[model samples]
Target: MKHLNIGLFGFGNVGRGLYDVLKRINSDNVTIKRICVRNIEKDRGIKAEFTDNPDDIFNDRDINLVVEVIDDAEAAYDIVKRALKSRIPVVSGNKKMLGHHILELIDLQEQYNTALLYDASACGSIPVIRNLEEYYDNDLLCSVKGILNGSSNFILSKIFNEKMGYKEALKLAQDLGFAESNPTLDIDGWDSLYKLIIITMHAFGVYVAPEQIFTYGISTMNDADIRFAEEKDRRIKLVAHVEKIDDRLIMCVIPQLISRNKYIYSVEDEFNGVVIKGLFYDKQFMFGRGAGGHPTGSAVLSDITACAYNYRYEYKKRNDSVLPRYTTEHTFRVYFRYKSAEQRNLLNFLKVREQYTSDEYNYIVGDVTIANLKAHQEELRTPDCFVAAYPFD
Candidate 1:
């Protein structure tokens, strides 16, 4: 077997972590042939040979493997695609880019006969992708729900568990390097949406866009909402969920109330957990340190290790032949927080479960159809309004 002569791309935190990890374990078998970065002037810590050209890595025969950890979605896709075309095995941690271009990449893998593994794209250190690809390929998955984004989970944990204010929680997350300066991607639920799309692809071999699947973040919560969740013995978590409803799937990334008894309830503060409910295997919880350089680096290294064995995700359920369609006809109870009656009236609920009112603010819990909520998502996502789904049993 040929040892991994890696052509690394992007020497950011994850890229640097990958290099650091490779040196500690199995150093003799793998070597980073080149490190590509946009800013060659800045200090990158290591003394490795660096370049600004994409072709330097792709065209190098010694560099049989490629790793991308950049921020740009379109550029990352282009580099990964080029690497596949070059017959080089690729590993990436770019979930947003992957989620958008995965179908195309799958086709590229088939056409080029090269492996492209991205274990780090979904749940940080959790091995959900590989497990879905290898273990649950044939099993009937009833649902897969979890706290997918570490930043969101961290904020919610502080609010519910420690009684910290929303602003303080967000600042703590940012200070701890769990959240970016512009935290919309994490707090607005786009991060979870990306991961959910990737997870759905591996689990059910289904492709659902962020728009098609319902998404509402935790930016709309108040002290009252937090109190309500506490009253119900539940914690508010940004849940990335996909469940089988009859023949179709209902996928959504929303801040939902989950019971304290559930495993996901305790998964807090930059930690991640996933509950995969299958027919044979009741509810399986996969927990891990979800964010930061070390955990995500470990996941990136996992994919790199598999690349040494010529391993690629054999998507048995998905191919050029067929794929399942997504449907949002399911029912769930939602909590809508609004400042005005207009926002409340805009909501199309099947039945109002409860209503609370005050001079300062108002909220209502009601049974809602996914279709109705999605139809009015624009109005619901405004500044003064907030929406979240709860465990409806």
Candidate 2:
């Protein structure tokens, strides 16, 4: 049997969980050779060789596997790039790194004859990526969308269910380790956007630049927005979505109003759910714990074990003759809330569905192009404004 000596990065939640899980599995041939951390003196609750130097793992040719669970995207990219260049298989949970540098990383894998598996990056424990790559590879995926970020979802759930304020719910999510080290990533929709970019590769076999997609977070959402949702018999959720409209694909991550009858309406806390629509299979829903140590660790472990057989993503869709073109020509009916008329004037609404005004709150429900939203994303993210999909259907 070939021994799989692993070099691990970042001994935080996911890292520690991977360690505990590896120990539980009792894979005698699989052993952690060394752990790399920013601070080596921090007590990690296990007796293992730890180092701050990246070369410790890079120089040790005996280490055939690298597991990177670090929070830093640029740092993780460097580590992953080096490992692949050395012909080492890597199992990563860094969505930000993969979202930004996946094309280059995949190229590296092909060049060096190594594998990169990151099932833990999106929809933790859901196995969505593998299913997209294998099970749905041949199927015509019409759309893939749902609650992709658990931290943001947790905050939304708390606000709607417990009547907790957004800031309170967000702080609670951070305290429970559901939110990322930089809460801005989760609350501001960048985390979900990053994961969405990764999923688009597997789902559509096309690489879409993150900048092209408009993302609006829940940080600016106020009680008026929540009350509006409540009055309309809907719940607010930070949703990441992509879909095909003829030959074009539209994608975005933003706070959306979900009706009660939807599959994802009940998804709460640190849980994730995805709805996939295909031409043949129709609609499929997948639900699982989306964040935290143990659940994500289980996902990482699956990827690690798959390395035993040297499995890698085939990216079959990329090789497809015809691929869907990502476009911003799509228009969606959305509810925009703002304190001042000037803020409301920022968006060019194609059609007005409804309008409400008051001293405390003012909003407009109207049709707005994806391009218009992307153009005014900075203004939309201001403290006085919040936007959500207002699909009445």
Candidate 3:
């Protein structure tokens, strides 16, 4: 086995967790040569070489691996690009970065003959990417749907099970390190959207840009929405779904009403659950802690270990002769709650199956196309509006 010298980026929670796990495992063949952080003097609480200069890691010929856990997507892209250009293997947990730049990065890796493994990028330690790359590469994959964000899931669990207010649950998650101080990415559903983009590439060999998918989060949810879900015997989960519909693929990330029979209905707290459906294999569920430091750090460690043996993702699905095309022409069953009839009219519902109005609440259950949702997504994010997608054929 070739000895590994790692250059780490971002000494935040996940980066620190990686450091601690490496120490605990005591892998004699691996060592962290340098850690790149924005603030070198921020008192990281452990002894290690730290640098504010990117070249400190890039210029060092001995640094054979780059593990990036940074929050800045652009900077992370630059670092990973430079490393792959230099023929160094990289393990990244930056889903936002990878989701945006994966097509180019894949080309670069092949051009320079290096590896970029990102099992840590999606669903923490569940190894979703690796499974899609290896296990389901030859299977007739029909759909992938799941809870992809643990911070949001944690908040939802608190709201549904503990009767906590959304803001209170969000604060608790942030205090426990499950969420960021400014959690627009998680709560507004961008985090899940980015993960879905990455999963789309692996599951169906297509690159769907983030903006193409319609995303609705739980930021606008309230007690009325919760009561409605309870009355229907359902739980609201932020679900990212990508399904191959004939020759085309349809994708979306939205707050969904999950019935009792679904795998993700009971996946509470910081845990994530993914249900992969294939033609022959049917549906397979993978569940684990989807956020925080240690679980993600373990995933990064697994990639680093694979690097020791010269393992890399083949991305076999991408090599298929006919790749699935992405489309937004499909429609979905939805439940929309708003403060006024004007807000309800904003969504171009194809047909209304149910409508309710009371002194305190007004909502409509109907069918709406993905295109209409994408066009009116910002309106749905308003304070008085909440929308949840219902399961429909």
Candidate 4:
């Protein structure tokens, strides 16, 4: 095997963890040539070498591999594209970059004849992409569903299990490093939405943008919703779901009331769980630590070791007879809790199943079109309101 030399980008939590893992593994055949960072002032505990310029990594011919784990989606894409065009293999954990520009990146990978793998993008420690490409390619997949966001799950665990307030739970999550300073992406469904997009592509060979999916979150979850979950014997989880309904592939990332019997109900507090349902096998469950440095580092290192041996995604679903169409016309059970009639009316329900009211909160369980549910996600995530999906069947 050929020795690997890597030019790594970002020396933050995941970056440091990757360095630590690689060092602990102590592979003599692989070495990190340089680590690039935006800030020079922030001191990362490890004594690895660092640089402020990204071009130094991309332009170097000796650096045969590029590992990117940065925040800026656009910059990360530029670095990956540039490295690929240079015929350097890349392993990235930037979900937003790939979610927004997968098709273009695939084109780059094809044109340059280089490898690009991001198994770390979706679930931290789960080999979702690898399994989809290898195991489920010809298995006649019916649906893929699971909890994808760790921060929201952590907050929800505190809120439902400990009866903690939403803000209080969120504060603890931030203090625990489970949440970012601006937790909009994690709390408002964009993080899981991005992951859902990536999952649909590898799971079904479809490339749909974030705007094309029905995305919702738990930003506005209140105590009344907790009581509702308690009464229903369910727990709230931020779920990413995609199912084939006729020719349409229904995809969404939303909070949902999972029954106690469901496998996902107990997957909480930064742990990710997914169920890939096939026509033959029924369902296969995958559970693991979804976030934190080591989990993400394990994913990154897995891809890196694969890259050392030159592995690339085959995207085998193209051989299937019928391709999938993205749609949200399918109806499902929806639960909405609001403080005012105006907020309740903002949602369009096909049929109202039940209703309950108190001085502070009004709860409604109803059937609603997926389109209408997604259309009102912003309003539902406003103050004193929450919206969640239920088992449609």
Candidate 5:
């Protein structure tokens, strides 16, 4: 049997899970040679040589592969760049790093003749990234819409389960370990924004930053909003959407009231589901556990296994195509919500395409388009206003 030595970074929840899974598999073909962590004496209870120095892994000559489970962008970027420069293959589960630095990393991989694979960054165990790369070659992916964040989904579920408001539900989610110590990213929709960037890059060949797309959170959601949506036979979800419109790609992460008829509406707490509308195929839905130590670990292991096979075969490939630049100016029908009558008057000046009135709030569905939603973002940021857009059929 052939053996491969692996270096692990950050033995946190996902890292520990990787170690446990590897132990359960009991594979003689692979061994964790070393682990790079911040606090070596923190009692991780794992049987591996732990070090605070990343140079121990980066500078090591025998280590053939590096797996990064660390969630920091700058640190992980530096480590992975060094590993790639050293001609060692790398597998990362860090979406934030991959989201911003994929192009540069791909460039480095080509220059150094190494592989940098990230299968777990977007969807855990869904294989959405690889599936897009391999399976649907000739088909045009019309759009991708899904529940990408498990933390926000857990909060939404708690709101429904306990009949609590958004704040209370978020608190419950935090208490139950479903949320992080600082959940600003998850709650503010930036986490899903990272996933959206990865998906767009994979599916549409587009590279979008968090700043390029519109993002909203479920923080403004209330029990009344949930009940009203439910009464209307709709489900509330923090949906990450990317669609192609008139040769432009428009993406957003926002709280949406989706009809129960939609496949994404059925996806509940801590579970993720992605729907891809292909021109050649029927709407495809892939659903599974979005996040957890084990599920995410499984994804990272998948990447490692692929990297190992590549090393075994000595196969080298490069993605030379330039990432597509997207414009956020595409027009779509929007569902607008308002809290006060004052802000509602401002909509009359922009364009009054269509409107709906609910008990808790009013909706203005229109073909109005904003050139750069983020530049004039203050106009949409009023506490009284909430907006969601849908592609017009």
Candidate 6:
């Protein structure tokens, strides 16, 4: 039997989960030779060599693969770069690091001729990236949208179920361990945006700067809006969307009122769902648990299994092409939820076409052809309003 040595960076929740899975699948074929953690004294019942020094793994000629589950972007970036430079294949679950430094790493991967697989970066259990790479060919993917953030989704579900305010629901999420200590990224839509960047890079082969995307959170959502959506047979969800229009890519992450008829509305709590529309096939939906140590660890394990195969036998690089450059000038449909009739009329004056009024709030649906949404952004951003925009067909 052939044997492969593995080194791990970070022993956090996801890291320990990875260790358990690999050990469960313990075959004479592979062994975890070393594990790297910041504090070696922390109790992580694994029986592998733990160290604070990264050089230990980089210099170890026996270690053939490195699994990086570190959360810090800068530190993980430096570590991953060194691992790739050493010709050791890397499997990472760090979305922030990949979102910012993927192109640089891709360049280095080509230079060093090593694999840097990141199956757990965007969607924890969903194989969206690999599907896009291997399954579809000559298919024009017009749009990709989904409930991308589990933490925000959990908060929204609480607001819908318990009729609580955003703050209360957020506190609940944090207490439930669904949210991070610094929940800014998950609540502010930056986490979803990072996932969006990864998916967009995989599907469209483009590296879009995070600043270029429009992002909004559910912090502004109120009980009134939730009730109004319920009344309209709809639900409010934080959706991340990217679409191709002509030669441009239109992307946004915001809270939207999706009709009950839409499959995304059926997705509740920490569960995630993605919709992909193509020229040849009808809209494809992929839904599952989008987070957790075990689910995410399973994704990383899939990458490791593939790497193991590639290590033993040569396989063709799937979709080996330069990342495409896309121009984003696409028009989008906007949904404006306001507090009263007066604000609805104000939006009507701004050329909002579709209007709906309830006892609690009023909403206007319109087409945004350009970047002029900023002119009225302040008025629309009132504490009594909610705004969402999506690329129009």
Q: List the residue pairs that clash in candidate 2.
A: none
lDDT per residue as tens, model 2, 1-393? 567899999888899888888888888878999999999888877899899999999999789899999999999999999999988899999999998899999899999999999999998889999999988853478899989899999988888889887788888988887899999999899999989998999999988888889998998988788889999999999999999878888999988899988999999999999999999888999999999888898899899888878889999989988888999888999999988978888889999999999888789999999999999999888878999997777
Q: Model 5 residue 222 lDDT?
A: 50
Per-residue alpha-carbon lDDT of model 5 for 1-393, expressed as tens digits? 235689999787678778888888998877899999877779876567999999898778788999998867789999899988898989888888887888788789879988888878787667888876666542366888899888898888767766656777677766654464468777778788888988877777767676777787766555445655676566678999887665667788877778757898778878889999888786999998777778888888888888877832111112434333477665555566776676665443245566667676776656545454455444656555766554333
User: Model 1, 237-330: lDDT tens per residue?
Assistant: 8898988655677898888888868898889799999999988878999999788777888899888889888888988766525445588887
Instruction: Give one clash count per candidate, in the order shown.
Output: 0, 0, 0, 0, 0, 1
TM-score top scorer: 2
lDDT of 6: 0.75
The C-alpha local distance difference test score for the whole of candidate 5 amounts to 0.75
C-alpha root-mean-square deviation, each candidate: 1.8, 1.1, 1.3, 1.6, 3.5, 4.1
Q: Evaluate candidate 1 by giving its C-alpha RMSD to the native, one decimal.
A: 1.8
Q: Candidate 6: misplaced stretches above 4 Å?
A: 162-168, 175-177, 311-328, 337-350, 354-365, 373-385, 390-393
Query: Model 4, 332: alpha-carbon shift in Å?
Result: 0.5
| Model 5 regions lying over 4 Å from their true place | 165-168, 171-181, 311-325, 340-342, 345-367, 370-373, 376-384, 390-393
TM-score of every model?
A: 0.95, 0.98, 0.97, 0.96, 0.87, 0.85
The per-model lDDT (C-alpha) reads 0.84, 0.91, 0.90, 0.84, 0.75, 0.75
Index of the highest-lDDT prediction: 2
lDDT of candidate 4 over 45-145, digit per residue (tens): 76766889887887777888999988778899999998888889999988888889888888888899999999998988899988887778544899999
Off by over 4 Å in 3: none
User: With candidate 4 superimposed using the best TM-score fit, by how many Å does residue 78's alpha carbon deviate from the native?
Assistant: 1.2
Model with the higher lDDT, candidate 3 or 5: 3
Candidate 4 C-alpha error for residue 284, in Å: 0.7
